[model samples]
Target: MPAPVQLYVYDLSNGLAKQLSLQLTGKQIDGIWHTSVVVFGKEIFYGQGISITSPGQSHHGRPLQAIDMGETALDEETFNEYLEEMRQVYTADKYHLLDNNCNSFTNDCMGFLTGGSIPSWIKDLPADFLSTPFGAALRPTIDNMFRGPAQGGSSAPSSAQPLASSLLQSVAQNATGVQGSTSSYLPTPAATPSPPLAASSSIAGPIQICSNTQHFNNLLSTHKAVIAFFTSHTCPPCRIIEPVFERLASEKASAGVAFAKIDLGSAYGGGQIASVYGVRVTPTFLFFMGGKKTHELKGADAGELKAQVDLLTYQAFPPHPHASLPLRATRSISLEPILFTQSVNFEAVRSRLFSFIDLSALSDERKKSIENSITSTIIPYLKNKADEREGKGKGVNTSISSGAVCEAWRIASKDLIDNLQVKDIFPLADLLRLTLLDNPVAQWCSTTAAASGTSPPHAILERVASALRNEQQIPKPVLLTTLRMAANMFTQTVLARTILVTRSNGHHTSLTTLAISCLLHDDSLVRTAAASLVFNMAAFYQAPRMEALRSGRRGEAEEEGDGEWEVELLSAVLEAIKMEESNEDVLHRLVASLAFLLHLSPFYETQLKPMLEVLEARSTLLAKLEGVEGGFTVSKKEARALLEEVGTKLCG
Candidate 1:
């Protein structure tokens, strides 16, 4: 049976409350109203406090209206889980009077339950009032008044008179622009929503059961890789592999592997589909890629299934370099802001940034121009480009705008490096880093060709790379930040290919050379970041190369100098592993990168023995050094399993 939903609305006062508040408090109270969702006959309310109040008790002599919102198909467990997630996002501490308040919570719940939002008039009341001239002028005072405490305390307004007056005062304050933190008022730049859930077959845990042949084929076609477990209701062996398959699916979902089960005895076309696939036995497993069968197995061997799935998962999407790394630092690293949608401590970061550079040579006007360009033009251009890529905005011409922004930054960067005797390079690199942090604008700028059919974006990156390579006195933080930004560029396949294949003056660009140089840097963090870059570049290149090879388009012909670079990268990683001291993060990245490079490269056999030897040595030492006061800390069992798994794959 579908679960019932009810929308309960309570007006704090009649029409007279608004006029009284304006005359007494000198502010317009749009309306003092509260809304809640009642599911399964429980009256749930969210405000300064969340409570399940008795249905009639919540009205408090005020006018009340209840609307039947139909029913929801969600099971109790799924609904509870979703509610928990909603609780995290709608935390009471983060609530604001005008922005994310009781109404916002109600709208979210209503949408989730009924697939429709509340009426727009009530939703837009606060925003509409704040747009007026008087509303604009009174906002600060209003925000300050309500910022004192959240409403609905244990010492609540008991009588209808006090409750109505207090609620009216609260709404008036909200109308005048009284709110929470400063970040609440600042408009978050809009971006396109992600593609609909149906477009991607990326699953998070759980083995999905396909209902019919069409369903099975659709999942296979949309997903990069799919593993189908064919079973029958009466087959006992199928039960053995059920739990194992679920566990493996959960572990590998993040790596882009999808798992499904088909009961051949079902009334759907499962029997016919199994016969077509030549599944003569129960508990048969079939692996598919690009709608073609790649591997098949009979019976229910959990170990073999795990190994095959693990191999296929890595082959599809390489593991994140830090996936297995155990945290060693007491505090986590602060993430850089997405300037478009996030609030940043601009003044603090800028003050620290200025101390690193000597601006005496450049006039105050020029310095201000540089700062203004970054704050006003460059940030917005990048933000817009990011939004456009995600299928958001009015389809702006980002290629031209982003190119201009990159050109401006390139000029500013060169000027600073030449004119200013930079006291510390870290701050400057950090500033540049923040601009491109996870925003693919840098890569797009580099790869997108100009009207002359010449790449201007490459020139910008080349300048940054040249500075890193030639400036021997550059601080470690500066070098690290520069390399991180460079790594981010390789996230785009075209940019990665350009970096790996492009050459200047009979040599690879300094950017590539700098990455290689950092592979053996004395600092562990630098080494890990560099290794991650190499892994990303190799993974991006391998996917298409492998596909081309499978299609017989690129037959066994390795790109020029590819082997040499792979060997150099592998050697550097092995040496880093041997030299690493108590840095689990470095060890994890090096191992993960090595696994990717080995599997993807043609030289796996040649490098296998030495790689295993290094791992064995490290594992032995790690065993003894485990839990020894910050000495080589890691999940020993996971480390051992990784080594064993890699060894088995190599030996086979």
Candidate 2:
């Protein structure tokens, strides 16, 4: 038995409190919390609830946000059963046609679909969708009966409340503004709807389940084990454990262990279910026997998950007590090799993606052919191009605008991001393993301190070094691009070691570095990159050559941001700057860097006088430029601030 199940939900949208309590109290029970609240870590849009309280017991809550999965602690296994049942209900006796109540008449009465916004495909329905034979059949419940022969879905929703108002609300609310945030906004589907049930009237326990608190109080008197498998479709661990839970559901339903699963959308818009549950990571299993949760499993793998489930299943669940796991700080191994290989498996992924595009809707065979051609050739072509731009190709110029280049990057992008997950790669496997063991900040808030994107620059450098040492011959373009990207990405202190290995006097001959130094590039971004690289020069052979350039003792053909001012060759760099004290922007930023250099060596007396003179000159020039107020604001403020700080320190 594990420790008593304890969850710390940060947001408590009380929408599903009732349904939640009931499903948890009974064995084989399930609940769908229609939390209007946003989601977290992932999406939380599963709106129906279900449970298997005792044979005679039952529970109910608000009209489901979507499907009305019956009462039970919903798990992957039982959820599938619910879908099958809904499908059967949809396929079976047309409730409107049944003699129960409808006269095929005024039943067109206003029906509120109430939850998610309707899907776009709804507009494609036939004109008579409301009054036609299909309409007449489904009019009583949903309206136009087109989806199937009967059940309420095929029918057109009545005119009083059009389909537009109700069907797709969930989908639209979570939509993203950019392709960047798209996956983060996707709604995670829970266990698929179960196979159809025999009849609405044939179930032993109450089929309709809800999260109402009142119903919850009444459910505790029955059943043995009620386990809530709070999960999400976006979670990697959840996928791993879903089948395991499914098997558990099948083997233990009659044995008295109940299951429930909730999609915690806390990571998205801060969905209430996740907020209330305080779910951060996935595969959180909360087990309850009688009315209270007895034990829980946090971060369970295959073996641990089975063990946890077994511990909670039979005799009253146990309470596990243990010290915190030890933390490890070193992150040496990587998961990149594995993930990249998988991303290149374009054929398989492409096939699966297109399988969802309904072919029946594609009318023109020519159009279909075009679609196939694009997917088969164009996409792959563009992807290869993007890889080349990213330095994945030999002897290719760095090009960001190539459509093929973007497409290839997207290929890597899609493979890495399978839903809310970044697939497991061996290179990252140990890195994540160790980073997580020691750094909580990196673990919980990855974007802040943890680096992840196409690839971290350090990781790329490491990959390059590894290949050179063992694999095929190292490509110069790959090495050069990696260095440029490294300078652009990490702080000097962070990438210092890697910078040493690849840079040398020969780097001047490297087209990659020369390309980066072009005057046409954005001055601000490129300047910052160049400075950062200069600050960390411990990697190359003949380090003093760089130091001599920096000191003005040796002058190279220098590239400036705007235009270069010609100067005679000098032995040290201070002389070059002194000789061209003409450009304001150049002087301002150099003065800015002086403070940094002073950090290493004190700016005492004799040296301070020259620095002060330049600072005063720049300040006067900038003040003249600032006469128009905000016109030259960046330079104006920067120059004045630079002088003020230097003067203060000198005086101090």
Candidate number of the best lDDT: 1
Could you tell me how far off, in angstroms, the CA of residue 534 lies in candidate 2 after the best superposition? 97
376 Cα displacement, candidate 2 (Å): 84
Instruction: Estimate every model's Cα lDDT from 0 to 1.
Output: 0.51, 0.30
Estimated TM-score for each candidate: 0.39, 0.19
Pairs clashing within candidate 1: 139-176, 142-178, 143-178, 143-179
| Tens digit of per-residue lDDT, candidate 1, span 7-75 | 776654444445333322223454556677778666655543344555544423222677777888776
What candidate 2 gets wrong by more than 4 Å, as runs, is 1-221, 266-274, 317-652
Clash count, predicted structure 2: 93
lDDT value, residue 70 of candidate 1: 82
- Residues 48-156 of candidate 2 have per-residue lDDT tens digits of 2111222111112222333221122324343334333323223222221111111111010000011222221211121112212222222323212211222212222
Where in model 1 is the C-alpha error above 4 Å?
1-344, 352-368, 380-404, 417-423, 437-440, 448-473, 505-509, 516-524, 545-561, 603-630, 636-640, 647-652
* Per-candidate clash tally: 4, 93
For candidate 2, the per-residue lDDT at 548 reads 22
How does model 2 score by TM-score? 0.19
